[model samples]
Target: MRDDVRRLLASYEPARQQPDPPLPPAGVLLLLHDRPGGPHVIFQKRTDRVRDHKGQISFPGGVMDPGDPDVRYTALRETHEEIGVRPDDVDVLGELDQMVTVSNFLVTPFVGWLDRYPYEWRFSSEEVAYLLEVPLSHLRDPRNLVPDRRIINGREYVFQAYRFGDDLIWGATARMLGNFLDLLSALE
Candidate 1:
């Protein structure tokens, strides 16, 4: 898997050429760890009390702080603050293309590996409701991926969603996950 990640990074191409300006920069960490059966990625269900995207399943990350040295550091710092994953513990494989969300955030997604297994996670009560560990194999299944459509202000919009139990991973998080999955699948 490490070799596959390296290969994907080495053959990297930017799908999103230019990000819209005036959007606040944000970073997200796609942290994968080895579980019993296979590699699993961690996600957090945001608390309903939070301001934005409440109750949504998301990666452990947030908007960049002024103190952050760089986008990768922002991701690492946010992950540490949100889920207690130290920056030193992560082995950064590479990054995905920059993505701009409807909420006016230019998100840079970073892919990282824990290198060790069976992680013990502690969640921040102010932000996260609970932690979700999903097997990569489950996401690889075609049946689990579905097209999500909805009408907002009489305009129809569609996006990709991956279902795990009753939870739906959609929006930006889904986009990042889909990209990661695509990268892995390309190696097959």
Candidate 2:
């Protein structure tokens, strides 16, 4: 999978598109690691007490701090802070296309590879509710994907989400996963 990912990313030129400026910059990591059965991606269920996006299933990251030299720094630092993944433990592959949230955040998603399996998680009680692993094969299954529609401010918006167990992976995280899977499918 690692070799395939590298080859696909190399052959494909990511737009690296940026949304309009002045939006608060944030970074999230699409962290994939080996598990017992197969590869899986890690996600955090945010504590309901957080400031924003409370109780949402999200990647382990937050807004970029001024001390962060770049978005990659933001992603690695936040991942380490939120969970227990050490910065040195993560092998960052590359970044996907940037996305803008309805709340006006320019979110940069970074894909990182962790060769090690079964990480010891130390969740920050203040931020993380719990951590869950969604198998890559489950995500790849089209039967698990669903589209939701809603009307907001007289505009109709649709969101694609993936369901695994009782958890609903939606919003930006879902979009990012879709983009990654789309690229992976191109390899076929």
Against the hidden reference, what TM-scores do the models get?
Answer: 0.94, 0.94
Local error of candidate 1 at residue 15 (angstroms) = 3.7
lDDT string, candidate 2, 25-62, tens digits: 99999999887778899999999999888898999988
In candidate 2, list every pair of residues with a backbone clash. Answer: none
Q: What is every candidate's alpha-carbon RMSD to the true fold? A: 1.4, 1.4
lDDT tens digits by residue: candidate 1, 141-188: 999999989788999999899999999999989999998898888878
Q: What is the lDDT of residue 4 in candidate 1?
A: 81
Model 1 pairs whose backbones collide: none
Query: In lDDT terms, how accurate is model 1?
Result: 0.88
Worst 10 residues of 1 by lDDT: 14-23
Q: How well does candidate 1 match the true structure in TM-score terms?
A: 0.94
* Candidate 2 local Cα displacement, residue 97, angstroms: 0.6
Positional deviation of residue 50's Cα in model 2 after best superposition, in angstroms: 0.8
